[model samples]
Structures are given as C-alpha cells and as structure tokens.
Target: MGLYDFTFYDLIHRNAVCYDGKPAWFEAETGATTDFSAFKTQVDCLAAGLQKAGIRSGDRIGVVGKNSLAFFTLYGAAAALGAIVVAVNWRLSENEVAFNLDDCTPKMVFADNEFGETITSLRDRLPSVDRFINLTDNGPLDAFDDLLDDAPFSGEPVSANDGLVIIHTAAVAGRPRGALLSHANLLCASLHLNHCFNLSPDDVHLNLLPLFHVAGLFMAVCAFHAGALNINMAKFDADKAVDLIAAHKASLLFDFSPILGSILDAGEKNGADISSLRAVMGLDTPETIERYRKTTGGCFYVMYGQTETSCLTTMGRYDDCPGSAGRAIPLGRVELVDDADNPVPPGQAGEITLQGPMVFKGYWNLDKDNDQTFRNGRHHTGDLGRFDEKGFLWYAGRKPEKELIKPGGENVYPAEVEKVILEHPAVSQTVVFGIPDPKWKEAIKAVCVCAPGQSVTAGELIEFVGQRIARYKKPQYVDFVESLPEKDGAIDREAVKQRYGGKQPGNS
Candidate 1:
C-alpha cells in the first residue's frame, strides 16, 4: 500500500482483527491490557458516539489526562471520526490550563478525574465546550467509560489533507502554541519512522513520556503501525520502569536523557535485568551518549526535532554511527541557515530548518504566528546546529532569543553551562539562565537539584564553576530549589522568570 494513501486510523483498524487478541496496549502499574480487536471495536464505538453527539470534522476535542489505555483509544477515535484532538498539559496551573482552553475553543473536553476541580473552576469561562467527559469513576460528570456502549462503526472515508490533531506546544520558556497537523502529515511521519527503524511486530515499546507531547504520541503511533506492542506508563518512575522492563521484556524503548539518567541510577542502586531491551532512543548530549553507552551497552539512537515538524526530522540509526541524529529521514530536506537565512559553512552553527510532508500545517488559529513559524514551505526550527566532518548533524544550542546573555556582553547557552555543571561530582541536575540585575544588565544564575544525600553550598558551586569556565560566565547567583521545574525536556524558564525574575539582591 502507498504510504500517502493511508490515514493513522486505517493502520489500526485494518490490523485490528489480524492482530486481535494480541496485547495492543498495556499499563504497567495496574497490569491492565487491551487487545487490538477490543481496542478497535471500542474506538469505532467511541467515534460513532461522538458523531451521534453532533461532533464533526474540523471540531476541536481537548483531551487532558495522565497516560492511560483509554487515552490512546480516545485519541484514535477522535482522529478517525475526523475531529481535531487537542491534548492539554494536565500539569499546568489552573490559570494556565484555563488560558489554553479558552484560546483553543474546543467543542468538547475529556479531562481526567484528577483535574475535575480545575475544570470545574474554569467552567464559567469555557462557554464553547458542549460536552465534558470524565476519565475516572468519580461521577457527577459524564463517564468516558460509557463511550464504548455505542454501535460498532468503522471510520468513514476521510481526506488525507484533513486536520487530525492540534498539539499545543508546552510553555517551557514561553507561552504555549498549538501546532495543527493533518492526517497525511502524521501518517507519512509514522510510515517513514517505521521503515527507518525496520520495526516489526516482535518489538515492544516501553513508553514513559507523557502522551500529550508529540514525542510520546508519534512513538505510540509508529509502534502501532509496525504492529508492535506498547507498554505504557503514566509518568517516569525509575523503580516502576525497571520492574516493567523486566516484566514485559520490552524490545524497543524511548525516553529523554533525564529519564534515562533516572533509570540508570535506579538500576545501579536497586538492580534490575533489562536484557530483553533491544534499543533505547531519545536526545543525548555527547557526554550523556558516551555515559549511556558505557552503562547500558544497548543501541542508542539520538533524535532531534520539535513538535511543529511532527516527531523527528533527523535521527541516527542504532549501530550506524555514535553521535549523529542521522541524516534527514527519507523525505525531509534539512538545511543549516545563518541569521540572514543564507547557507552557513559545513561546520558553522546555524538554525536548523526542515521541509517535508511531515511538517505540521501551521499553528492552530494563530495566523500571524503561523506565518512567522513557516517560511517558504520550510519549518524554521529555532535550534542551533552544525554538520560534522563526517556529515553527521550535531546540536550546538538553542537560538539567541532562547539563550542567556550574561553581564559584560558574555553569551551563556544554558545547555553548555548545564553540561559543565553536570560534570561536577556533587551536582545531579542544573539549570543556568540569566536573571535580571541592576549592577549588571543580567547576571548568570544557577538553580540546581542535588542528588540524594549530596549537598553543596552556593559559594562552593560558584568557586567550582569559576575554576572550570571563564570567570565572566560563572554564575554570580545560585539558588538551590528542592526541584527545578521542567517541561518538554528543558528547564522551566518561564516559571523561573515569573517566580524570581525582577527585584534580585542586586536590584537598583
């Protein structure tokens, strides 16, 4: 079958009966599993139920919850019936959550029982929502469980170009923006990814990343297309991860480096067998990649991309090379452009740009923002990168707007500073950013999360960093928070600024 001809819904339903009774999706904690046949039937029923409820194509349906077996089904059902799936970040504060819901204007919302209070609080503000379905047994709201009671109906013919999902990018350093994706875009991405990995039904994916993000959702869809089993988790818990890996014999797994660090520490301390694991994939800074290789001895694939371009534009194949994020996958055209949008020298740092079928249509309902993000049909990814002598892509850092400019006109990339901080014996995790100051235009600040039973003073850390890097680049201010916030694999810059931006000790 031609890759462009198939929709994501087609892949699951066609294999539903063929892979029926096979474990389609499994939850680690509860040991709950859903077979493909049952899942397909339920998805069809749910789609019909939504259709019967007057939901139609082009309508937005917001889904907010921790990872659950029902989450996948609900997402698929929404897409199959030609409705746009708007997956919300449940971890957001009540205000942030309300802001996004109001901005997106979804026709219906399916929220977890845990978020009932938050949803109820914003009920007065969300006049656009026609239905509110709850994920858990806590009543007073319509139960999502009742969705399965409708007639078993298959997906109707859908256009490849129709909108499928509106994934709102998390506000790691700025406000969240929703990227609209079409059925063709997601299907093409999944197909290319499946082929590149040589995915097979024998493969089992250990998924711990939140389902709301493109990283998690694309991985799940890619695994499904390959007829692979998916072992799902609500969040990344190191101990539970080890148990699930040992139990399921998961052959393929994907997670970010931070999560990987946790898994490695858990293994070293508590001890667990992960012999069945064939490959572990995600973002890996060069140092982290080497450390991961020494510890796991499993094939590691370092991937690089943003949600706006679907899951990935570049990734190195396992066992192909050590540090590259691989050549641009199949259909994608990857380019390195300077500030003026001119091609940079092979080794020179430039913004990584990509154009392909996998790129999203545009940010949902934000016309001016969409125009700015997409240029000449290429998605301008605001990441700095360069090509190696061997033609492997290496991520340098983020764009200047995203960087921390320190006092004395010194530029401090957080990733670079964090890398050096991570090298310190006592420091487990660190985030360095420029905090506003009066004496200096901006002062470098370090907020670190220490390893258990480990302690280091701010002065000691300042001295430690001074000995390693340039004096100007060393943090002038250091704060030890219980935990530095994070979203989408990066530091929570927005939260940090809001909490401790203005009126520092050196304020005017």
Candidate 2:
C-alpha cells in the first residue's frame, strides 16, 4: 500500500472512528442491524477467517446471492484482504452461473441457500474452487459465520489500485466478459456520488436492487461511505418496500423500470407515509417520474453509466432536463466520438466514450478484448448519444455491434437470445430485438422464420429458448413471419426491427 493511498478498508476504519455506534446497515429478511463500529469488527474477523481459508491477495472469491448482510460482509472482507470478489448474478440459469464461476475460478465460493443446490451441482466443473460456503443460516453446508475468527488480519497491506470486484456484463461475443474494478475505482465513484447526492449520516438508503448489479453495489458503497444507513432487501417486493420506507424514513433509493411505479402503487394502496424519501435515482419512465414527483415531492435522478464505469458517469435531476441523461459528472470525461474516434459536434449522435479514475481496470483475463475496448486511450461504451445546446446529454441508442435490451433492468443481448432460438429444429432464421413495454420499460421481441414444412408456435419457441438460457433473456413477445428482409444476401437486422419491432396482435 502506498503512503498516500486510501482504500475501501481505510474507509471502513475511518467510519468506525467517525461514526462509531451509528447504524450502518439493516437486513430486512432477518430484521438485524449492525452499527459502524461493530460492522468494522465483523469485517475484520471475516477477513482473518478468509485469510486462514487459503484466500490471498489477488485471489478471486465467488459470491452468488441476493442483497443481504452476509453478502456485503464478504465485500468488506475482500476489500480488506485485497481478494477480488467475483459476484455472479443469482437470477441467471445454472449454466450461466457455472460459466461465471469457471471464468474467474474463485478459490472460495459462497452462495445463499437458494443457490446451494445449484453450486453443489456444478462442483465438478469449478476446478479452482477449494471450498463452497453457504451464506445463509439454514443451508446444509459450512455456513459463512463459521469462517469468522477473532484473530486480527495479518495479510500483506493492500493497495488502492488492486482489483477488488469483477462483475460480468451481458454477452457480446456469445459469452459474458468480467469487468474488473479496483479499490480506487469504487472509492472514487462512491466519493463522486456522495458529493452529488449530498449524503450524510442521517440519510437512509433502501437497497432493492440485486448485489450482483453495478448500480446496487455502488449505491450501497456510496451510502456506507457517507455513514448512511442501508436497508437491504433480498428481493424487491413493492408492498414490503413501501412498508420499509415508511418504517425507516428512507431518504433515497435506486430504481429501474416498474420498481418506482410499483412502489407508488403500493404506497397508495396501503396509505403508507413515504414523504421522507428525498431522492430516487436510476432509469424510469417520464410518467412514473412525474407521478413520484407529484406524490412525494422528491427528486428523480436520471443517469447514464455501465458496469465498466464503476456505476455512474453522468447524473442529474430529471426536472433539470426533461428528456436528457444529465450532464457529465465531475470526476470523468464523457465524449461523443464518431467511428474514427474523432469528437462529434454538439447536436450530432456518436458513440459514448469515457475516461477517468472511475473507469475500470479492464476485463479479467481478456487481453485482446481489453485492448480493443481501451483503444485510443478511452473506454468505448458502444452506446450512442448526443448533447444539446445546454450541455444536457440526449441518449440516442446503442451502436449496431452492441445493440442491447433491458427487460426490467437486466441486460440481455439479442445475439445471445437469437442463438438460442436458432437451436430449435423448426427455426431457420430469426431476429431478436427490444420493444417498448409499459411495465418493464423495454421487452425482448423475436421475429422468426420457420424451417420449410416445419412450424412452431410462439409459446413453444419461447419455452425452448427459456430452457436453454436465463428466462429473462427469452423473448417476451414472438411473431412468426414467412421470411425476413435481406440485403446483399444477408439478413438486415435494422430492417427487421423497423418492420416488426412494434407491438402486434397476438404477439404477446
């Protein structure tokens, strides 16, 4: 560790002295609360135990679970020990989960009871995993608490620039790639957000998003850094969320699609008092933003960022620019560049690229991909956007090569889904794309061409795809077409989207 460096572990120690007995986090499932001083002690003990379990600096620790006290505790322990935490999305299929675990090849794999059986089934496939520890209490295995020890952490000092976490993004080339984030990346991002939100010890954050997601992980870190209380929910429940908000006077939260809408509905249905909520951040529809504003008089913050950027690159209140994604954040440089990597003039659409401390180190163990992504000294986001005269960023869409779909905020690449669809015997050609949906904000829609003399129903094809991949990646809407448009003997994906992307009768 450098003399001038300040890592996440340093922040935990600082908070222990500064905030001491103040509440740091609350687990909704267990109704357990841990204060800052005790939180630090727990993290230290966990770190000592993890070190004894053969975990060392630069080692990868796999975690697959929902938002919980145990999950965040592991994060703290990893940060202190300089071990990289490869947090896998629990919502993924067993195959998907195995792919992620094998990709990182963690020394120790920790999972909640829900995924205990799934991990056990894949034990043979994970060669590097020496131990599988359960994160919950009821699991029939070695519990995470068993790893706790009172011994002080005697590991080598960890540097701020050392890799801390690895979050795998949506598949771009038939498989997902892990983006490695360092301690400085996360600490810098948390500091930036702390300044942006004006967070303090009195603030209460309702953490509903899954811990495997960037938004969820970063927001929790930011709240913790600010000495704010984070109330964690294993999974989002609108009614339960409303009750928690009323009970805790939560000051802020991160939302995606129907979450904010459902919260409003639940608040009204229960006559719950949620007036304490001050700021809500993330992606949501304009109607829902307006409704939230009218109902609670709270600010709705919109942002544009990716997992590679440590969570956020730009953020601002929705009312500031009705349809814009806010302005560039202070800590990073956001530019709109053309294909040649030249800067585009204002009012023109171009790919969004970013650079700064907040930018991640690189994808884990993928040198060629890292080179291509970090070419020209900037991280190519593969997303397109434009800036207006007043400096507000207007998000256009994604580049063709990186076209993406988010059904309820989970990233789903059309190419991955298209591959699964084409596996069916009855499918000859298929095009998968995203379409606007009232509930999810964006829903996956598939336009398929069946093989000659072989027909398949939409339900049958959807089920076939679901069985092969994560259910969320399966098409929510399917349309059978006789044939797809072609250009130069190749399927024109743009043409297919333009012609059949909209909602159709009996498609859903």
Candidate 3:
C-alpha cells in the first residue's frame, strides 16, 4: 500500500474512470456484456461480500472454472482484499484436483456447476474450506451471485507485492507445485505485453485459452489493462471463434498448436471474414504460423516463458527472427548460465535464467525448491537456450532433470509420464519423450519393453495411463521393443530418444 504501488485493484479502479461506459468484456455463451464502470461495481460488491464472509489479507480462495465473468470478478475481488486465489485446472483428474485444493487449503472454493458432484465428494478431505460457492446459475451449493453485496468494501490495504494467485505448474517430481504470483508480477507482465502487442482501447481480444494457464490469465489482464474489449469463451469452438472474430472484429488472440490452424480452416471453409486480426501470439508450428499470416494478414508473434516468469519473458514477430524466440523483453533480463552459475558465450546453449519484476514470488510452500531455483541471484528456469549474436534466443530444450513436453501448450514432464507407464504390469522398461507433430506442435511418444511372459497392446497401455492420470498426459504414440539401450546400469533416455525420435512410429 505504498504511495507508488499499483495492483490489479488499482488498475480496475483506474479503468472504471478512464474507460467509463466503454464495453470491457463480452460473454460469448450468453451474449452478455459488461462495461468498465459496471465491472468495477461488480468487483467492489463481490469484494465487500467476500470480506463479510471472513476473507482477509493472506487468505486463500480456490477457484475451479472456465473463463467467465464470475471467474474474472473473483480475481478482482481477491486482489482488492489481498486474498490469494488458487486457480485450479478443472481439466485435471479428481485426485489431482483434490491434491491442489488440499495443498492450498483455501478458505472458500468457487467452482462451475459441472463440478458440483466432484467437489461435494471431496468436502470431507478439505478441512480448511469453509464454503463451496458455485459460479454458475444453478448448482447444489451457494451461488456466487448470492455472495455479492452492495456495501462498500472495508478491508486492510493491499500491497502490490502481496501474493494474488497460485497456479499449479507441471509436476517435476511426483506432483504439481503451486507457483505463487504477486500483484506486481502480473501487472508488470500485462503492461509489458500490452506494449509488445501495441494494444489499445479500440482492440478486441478473443479469450480462448483457459484462465488457469499463465498465458490465458495474463493475456486477459493485458487486454483489460489496455482498456480493450475481451470476448471470453467458456470453451473453444473453432467455428464459433471465427464467427465471433468476424462479428466483433477481434484484433488479437493467443494460439497454441492446432487452435490457429483450426481457426484458419473454419474461416476458409465457411467463407468467414476474419481480416480484423492483427496480432496472433503463442507456440505453433512454422507451417501454421505461415498459414495464419497468409490467411489473415496478421503478425505471428513467438515467445518463450514459464509460469514462474508470470508470462512472456521474450516476444517478437515470427518474421523478425524467423526461428528464434525473439529478443528479451524490456522488463526482464534473460541470460544463459553454465552448471557452475557462470555466464555462457552467445552461441553456446545453457540453462536459461531470468531476473526482474516479472519473476514470480516463488513456489507456494517449497522452500528448498525456491532456494535452489533462486540461487546465484537469478531464477534458474530449468530450460536450456542459446542467444545468437543479434540477441535472439534459440530454444534448445529442457535440462535432463527438467525434461518437459508441451502437447498443445499444456506442460507435461517426461518423468511424470514415464512413472505412470512403469506402473503397468506388462511394462518392464520404458522411456517417454516429445516428438514434433503437425497438430499439437509436440506430442508425447513412449518406447517400452514388454515383460518376459506378459504382453500388452499399445492401446491398452495408453488407456491404462490415461485412466491413472490426466488424459492429456497419456502418450499419443507407443512403440514396443525387445530391449532398450542402457548407460551406467540405467535405461539411457537419450539413446531411446535418438532411436525413436522420428515422427513416425517404429522408425528404428
């Protein structure tokens, strides 16, 4: 609450005055719109009601839902009261959802009506959760709309450095770790992104990504910070997205893998006019980027970032550097470091480290992890990359301990997948890795050796893993071999990848 401090609450208040009656957000499902002024009023009332419900500074509020007015309002209300919102990925399995909620120990849980049964079943396990508020109109629990009060918000002053949200990232070990993000982290990220995308009040943003993801939440916040209109979709429908763009003249959107591809296909097939799109940002294949650019005449921006960095650490137009991940953003310092914490020359690949305002607070409750990550005065991203002489970064994949695979932008660690594959009785040795794919940009592939007397089909093993974990984490391609290469008495993952890295199955 310093004199110069600026938080999301401050941004909302400023927009309410600056933008006034201008349309701020549009709900695609219901065709409802909320202007900036009305948005502020809703947030204030929600904040007052939440405070009355015993929510205080440092309190945790769990939210599991899609992109909706209620979801964004909860974010604003929590920020105003200095309460941290734990945004859970509703796409996860019931056990995974329960694990995240238990880890955060929220005071209240707000969820979409679709998850009423799931949350109700976990009520006994969540001792810290006092109330379960439903975000939708009809549900078994108390409705989120009922929590709104017209009374003025009266709570302790909030600081920009206070933790505002906790987003669980990919499991590096056995379970996902909640990454705590402060108000300053998100505000800085949004401001930087707004500048990068040249966003303005006249812009219309199509919110397609899930709010639980860093990219989704940051993009929405960036659009709001720019005083632009954000059209939110509870779930992505390619045809509906094209129609919305044509009808609303959306100027920007964030794409991952087949999203952009599907939009282009839908637009071409239906003769939909989507010429208004000016900037499209996210991870996608070169072919898709080229198609999007040629089809819509928009700039395809590339970036490299993690949840720990709040959002984009580096971003620039695709054509600017062609294949590189653009230059480091103005707000942050991106550097490459060797194993001993020394700087590496421009051309050599090394672990990526970040430092600046956009860096997140730290993992929610993992002190040892924070200590290791923040060592040497910079946040070790566990990702490897190299910078060219011109300063554009070329991503070189993740470190061994942090081996990751992003299928359609969702982080999936190889170790986590491998762990699940090993649980099958018919599997003796296995290695999981990522391979380039036309649709998902990257798809998980597993090479395994069957047990001596037990045999299992690829489909059976894939289904077994899917049932045990999130379906997205399941391998898209599986290949069985009699023996796998070994090094130092351990299964050599690198050897396995080198042999099976080809896009087609049974390549060896």
Candidate 2 to truth, TM:
0.98
- Over the stretch 1-508, how does candidate 1's per-residue lDDT look in tens digits? 2345666677777889678788888988688888888788878888888887878877888877888887888777877877888887775556657767877898888888778777877888889998888866564458876755567575566777788887766443435577888888887878877776678988888887778878788888888878888899987788888788788887676755456667767767777876666677775445555655776666677677777778888887645666567767788888899877887888899999998887888877778877776866668888889987776787776685666453532335566567667777778877677765544546788788888888989898888776654465578878787877778988777777567555666455
lDDT tens string, model 2, 225-271?
99999999999999999999999999999999889999999999999
Which candidate number would show the highest lDDT if scored against the true structure?
Answer: 3
For each candidate in turn, the TM-score is 0.78, 0.98, 0.98
**Tens digits of per-residue lDDT for model 3, 1-508:** 6797888999999999999999999999999999999999999999999999999999999988989999999999999999999999988888889999999999999989888888998999999999999988889879877898998776688999999999999988677999999999999999888888999999999999999999999999999999999999999999999999999999999999889999999999999999899999998878888988888889989999999999777889899999988999998889899999899999999999999998899998999999999998899999999999999999998898888899999999888888989999999889999998878888899999999999999999999999878899999999999999999999888999999886684422
Badly placed stretches (over 4 Å) of model 1 are: 1-4, 154-156, 170-174, 285-288, 291-296, 318-321, 402-508
Question: lDDT for model 1, on a 0 to 1 scale?
Answer: 0.75
lDDT of 3 at 366: 94
Off by more than 4 A, model 2 = 505-508
Model 3 residue 396 lDDT score: 93
**Candidate structures ordered by lDDT, highest first:** 3, 2, 1
